[model samples]
Target chain A: MDSSPLVLTLASIILASTPLIIAVCGEILTERSGIVNLSLDGTMLMSAMTGFVVAFETDNVWLGFLGAMGVGAFFAFIVAFGSIRLRQSQFAIGFVLTLLGDDLSAFLGQNYTRIPGPVVQHYAIPILKDIPIIGPIFFNQNVIVYFAYILVFVTWFWLFRTQPGLRLRSAGDRPEAGFARGVGINFQRYLYTIIGGGLVGVAGASYSLNIKIGWAEGLTRGFGWIALAIVIFGGWSPIRGMFGALLFGATKALATYLQRTFPEVSVVAFNAIPWVLMILVLLLVGSDFTERVITVAPKSLRRPLQRFLKISPPQALGSTFVED
Target chain B: MNANRWIRWVWPAVPIAGALVVTSLLLFFFGAAPLEAFQAMYDGAFGDQAKTLSVLAFWVPLLLAGTGLLVTFKAGLWNIGIEGQIVMGAIAASWVALRMEAPSAVLITVEILAAMLAGALWAALSAVLKTRGNVHEIFSGLALNSIAIIFTNYLISGPWQPPEGGTFRGTAPFQPGALLPLYENSRFSPLSLLLAAIAFTLVVIALRGTFWGLKLKAIGQNLRSAFLLGVSSEREMILAMMLCGALAGLGGAVRTLSWFDSLRQSISGGIGFMALLVVMLANYRMFLVPPIALFFSAVLSGSITLQLRTQLHSSLGGILTELMVLFVLLFGDWKKLGVFRKKDDDG
Candidate 1:
């Protein structure tokens, strides 16, 4: 019952939630464009492995970040192509890509198990770092942690204020209206999904190079699912998504604290906390939240891009827009 | 109109044929001749008495799981948590088998019921979330899967730990009488096959002949229309999920009682996902379920043979199976291809 431990516990929760905040923010952008990339989990896992492996080999964390983003973009392209161009079900294609991504990552990462990754050094702002309890928890974090906050503000500004952001929102909200206005709805979806996926990939790389600093099989263990849930919890807005990530991160941090404090409680049972929380959140939010969040979502998302479905996703989310 | 009739029957058959050709090419990559691999696969799966029995041993659980998936798909609900349900079923059945020292007949009956109940209850949670909480069934089911795995791990590693200091991987072995009687002296068990066959037939009948089955199909095809017609969409969805869970649970039970003496980690071994693939490959057709299940069973059984004969990785089978699924999915939508289109004759 030491109050000191509780304070430490609160600090660690913010730290644990950083990667999730980064990932969910990226997913929020992706989903806003009307594409539910179920492959986020697999993409993150693969990127985590690739990023760590490259960093381990090159001893450059930047290379790890780049490698992770590259892999994420590549997988996103597959999903986009399969569902968008080929006119397959996004859910099915996304699910397949996820399975493929997971298997491929595991297969490729077989040799890199437990390999140490280059540690991402933390940078503390001089004045901010010295600001008591809030300073250490917020200001003193790895470069990615700072980037995550910046990205949230940047995303918020771009999504609500910029012309391109307005256009993207229009495409998500009502593609027909966007199409009538001569907006390139499909291109916008493709742009956002790939960008969002790349960000998610970076988050995965952060897990290995910054957070854990090592590779292992099934290393992600369902962080991707948590990120997916966070997107909904955030009500599909980038800024709110960050808060959702913090909530999940806090829960995870608390679970760790509990496991240590109450040794009698099984750690395996404790691990189920996030998933149980996800279900509860989904139940509590109801469709009203979904409707509100998806109000700004891309119009063509759940709809197939094909003529058969007639009410498909944007004409171009998954299709390759090759100029003839 | 004539073309429509032709394409309806022709479309489904096309993917199966395409799958075979692609699968042949994959076999060739492993340094085995395409024809020989086909022969071996067929022979290995059904060539001899012993092999056929082993195939049946694998087929029973797959068939049961696939039929369960078929039910959910018909209701427009994708219960991907079948793997989790299967594990819960196996755990429940094993719990009873380990605790009770009843007669073989009574033990078998009780185990099956326990497995079905466990599976149904597990699926019921997702159904409730979908109906009452308005949660998306897929995510809810996926989240439940992790929780189920954690619960299973807890049971095996904690309370269900065997008396001896054996490997902490699986539960304790079942008693001699607890096991299903084998088919004569062979490794194949008649009881599992009988259950699978009965389950498959029942599913087909339920889907095609029963009023409930028709309601599920209507709901699946168009929920709004079905609801307008006074169909209780929520109830139908829940019932479909429950039925799906029960079948998957039975698969788990059979696997435990007949094949493995104990419940191992990953006992379902991606079979639930494989069942999803089977349902997709079969176009959600009920009668086509068994053959497709058998085909997948052959691919899996052959991969093991290939591994033993050629020293390849056992996971090669999974890779190949995934490849087949990928190709089939892409091919199913081949109507979108420009080349496949008839030229428009503008006057």
Candidate 2:
């Protein structure tokens, strides 16, 4: 059963989604702090380039990850400083940085393109890897993938089950209230944004060193945008975001499966699936149609449905918090 | 008054200089000579008549996209789906060109109209999604943009494959009647430039001299208050988006008919996104659109040669432009500068 195509595909899907899972986690934290770092696409591209280059030059994968985290934090710091202190438009600056990061990565990675670099070593948990189908699908992966799994639960716990989490939520939802409670709103925004950006940086490094394994122009190009969409689909919760990432991975795997099964089908057609899914998933959460559906449902189903389908962005997601 | 005039000239220069320093430092870090790269880029963009004309040809579509964005920006809409509008326009024009056979003048006129209508409809989708479904235009626009590209790929590869076969390049070059007349064996079309200029002038007038422009300004400043003042925010927002889409569609038509003479993949080639950058760099000002768009066009065109001469990546132009916009956003407000604050305090 473990060697069957179904199990193999499921295993690969888990492996492929690690970066996206990591990226969504990062973005959730950032957006929760009332900052939208729309530069995820470019940041990932630049950091992917940086990660590969540093690893190649230093012959150390850990250093590459560190360098990437630093780069990510630096970019997020700029976003935080500009939006929080300088009071510029977050979207505009983020968009510009996306374009800049793309170009900068291409220009800087010119020499690094297609060169062999350090690859993340795989380490399956000894006992866990032996635990039937689930073991092979989840536990039998590289350290980065394992780290992503742990990060998801940690993120969920940090955001929902802690005292600091309440302050963070207040920082995004009601800055005035948070300020009244003596929270350093700006400082919280900066700290969380940088930390989230560093996680995104890890996602980028994961791509270059583990999943994709080389430097190239536009390496991991559209994934960042997809990750952004997934953050919305997940309704700003890390646990839900992980499922969104997995669903995206499953669709991609299905596309690959279809292409292999039906060679006559143009592969380009399948490229549209994730994007179309992005629209549909967003529609599901963004519209009040879900609420209407819940209204018509049985009482027992309605509560569970409401818990699952409810989606609302942070009140101060894109606005500058001017504290008195 | 003289100092104020001088300050206006000098202030904008700050961001440009900052961009230059940052780009130069990037080059220096990468072991490339900044001066040499800049020289190469300049030579590549304006080395001769052909290069200059190429820049102008590129400028026409970019200028149109930038001009259209002024309307949406005035109404406080992002309209990022402008890229899709351009793509839909190209597809519409392509459909007419591929299916309809008529005199050149009639065919061209119909194609342009079809392109504009298609673009308007596409933009309208995002607007409706926002007003009715409560989805943000940014997300809807992005989704629609992907759908447009997917539709293009499906059409070119599946239904509209060339007579010989499909290599995914594009439909066979359109009949002469379907294509815009070129000038001096170049892809440049004088008619498209004229159309773009007309669009620019009309938008400027619409934005500066009309009550509609005032309403849009009111909406942009505060939508709730604008609604309270009896303005129909929904209708105006939709109209602004459609207007921008129409202009962008014309840009796509220009691109397909003049730039490549076929409905090719990636036909918009980031022109719509570049237009977003151009408008942002212009600080959403109307009159500044043309010159800034032209500058961006020149830089991009020059980067092609800069790649060959300096062995640098062609995205060097994108980096330079993006940095300028970034710095401007960070420090563009002259009143926020410490020196100006002191001056205001003295006054």
Candidate 3:
């Protein structure tokens, strides 16, 4: 086998996995806080559509990025409202939001299909760009790629190495403990979920701004699901999640490579490889991963932190600390 | 006591009223007069015997799919892969329909059975993963949906491709003898409707009058408690999935034998998701599924007419259906409102 093609293939996989890396990392943070948001798929889809539309209209890729973040935040707010304020079932509300997001995207995006948008250009570092095999692959990428790496590090640092991160984790893991310490656990959850959602939105926008540069019906095509799966595979840690995403990206890239090489193998089966791989990874990892990581999940996230239900938020997460 | 009795009726009614209001508002936004659009929808769906039959044609598959979903819901499982199961079912039915040379009656029966079995088996994968492998049913169900679509695509594009190259996107048409005969020059097939009705009735009876239904409901409300009570929650979950898959598979078979004659790419056509909406709106009540399913089918059938008569895209039917579900879910909480609030120990 030619190393050149393999090298090129590896490079492509890295690029493909960047969005998943970012999105899953964000979701890990949100879930660590104790809420399960199944609406990420819809959030990504809507953001992808919005990013493309805004980019095309404004000719500024940054605007598309921001627009996608706004839309993503808005969707997260809806999930928050339903799960936290309304006391609805987290899974049900998340599912409904997913459906609603999908339809809303389709309704709004009907006209923008196939339209060209502003494509983010690569900014190669002179020294790094010249480094043989790794140079072009790693050093010669657009801002979004760099931003994805930055986000991974930022998230990793924020999660493990900072005070606020610890508090956020506490809020998610044991809201009662956090609340007993006088922390407003619900507010922390609300803050982090909205911010995490905004990041996921950016990840979604990156699909259009950096990857495909256009929109299509069902364009996300279960990428959100892949991201969700990756969050678990990564053990809900930013660094691990990034690795899982890269692994998936590699598999996806390999599938594409194999499809081109082995034209005889049905493309339909090839397309299914990622989903099959996700299921396999999920099964192999077992349910312990979900239990372990989720055990530390924020109390507010436990039961639709956004909805108004019979249960109160981790007894601490959502309280505003009203003084007598 | 009388007021308390009325509360039961009010729970279901409020959601319906809210849905209607929301639908009207959506129609108004679309620049169609709400009343006129409603009239058009009514006429399009049931203006004539032919139209009524067309509505029934759509209704049967949806009703069947919804009924299958209800079974899973009873067992505290959400089988979102109904779409995939339906697709697989169609594939199985089409495979048999296209190949077999048996008598129509025998072939149709075999095809239906084959489809149901295939669907049940596909659904069983999720159950096995959930019960034995500890994979969440939701994740398994979602993953199965993707796998199903891919499998369908492979079959259609490869083994099942019609001989014609340019236009045919599905399997070859079934033999005339293999097809289910419709009643007297009507587009509606009584066979499908009758099958759907019987299936619904059976499910209703099973849920209300059988020990199994009680076991299923018990598990759905609290799996741990059910397990403690020796209900075999895991087994019941698997059984529910199989039953759900079988009903959906039967619906797929009926569509192939009675309506299409050939298996198309979009044979299931989002019916699984639509059925989900129907089930949710009906609050997972078995008897409530039919009327809701019929109402949705009428909306869909009417949309085709609206497309022919107006400039609106047929996709409007899908939009309306999604909106209807959203409205139902949104206002489903009206019973908690102050006006309807029950007197309690605390405010």
Q: How high is the CA lDDT of each candidate model?
A: 0.77, 0.88, 0.77
For lDDT, the strongest prediction is: 2
Q: Give lDDT for model 3.
A: 0.77
**Weakest 10 consecutive residues of candidate 2 chain A by summed lDDT:** A1-10
TM-score of each: 0.85, 0.95, 0.87
Candidate 1 CAPRI assessment class: acceptable
Query: Which residues of candidate 2, in runs, are more than 4 Å off?
Result: A260-267, A298-302, B1-9, B337-347
Using DockQ as the measure, name the better of candidate 1 and candidate 2: 2
- CAPRI grade of model 2: medium
Best-fitting candidate, scored by TM-score: 2
- Candidate 2, RMSD to the unseen true structure: 2.5
Using DockQ as the measure, the top candidate is 2
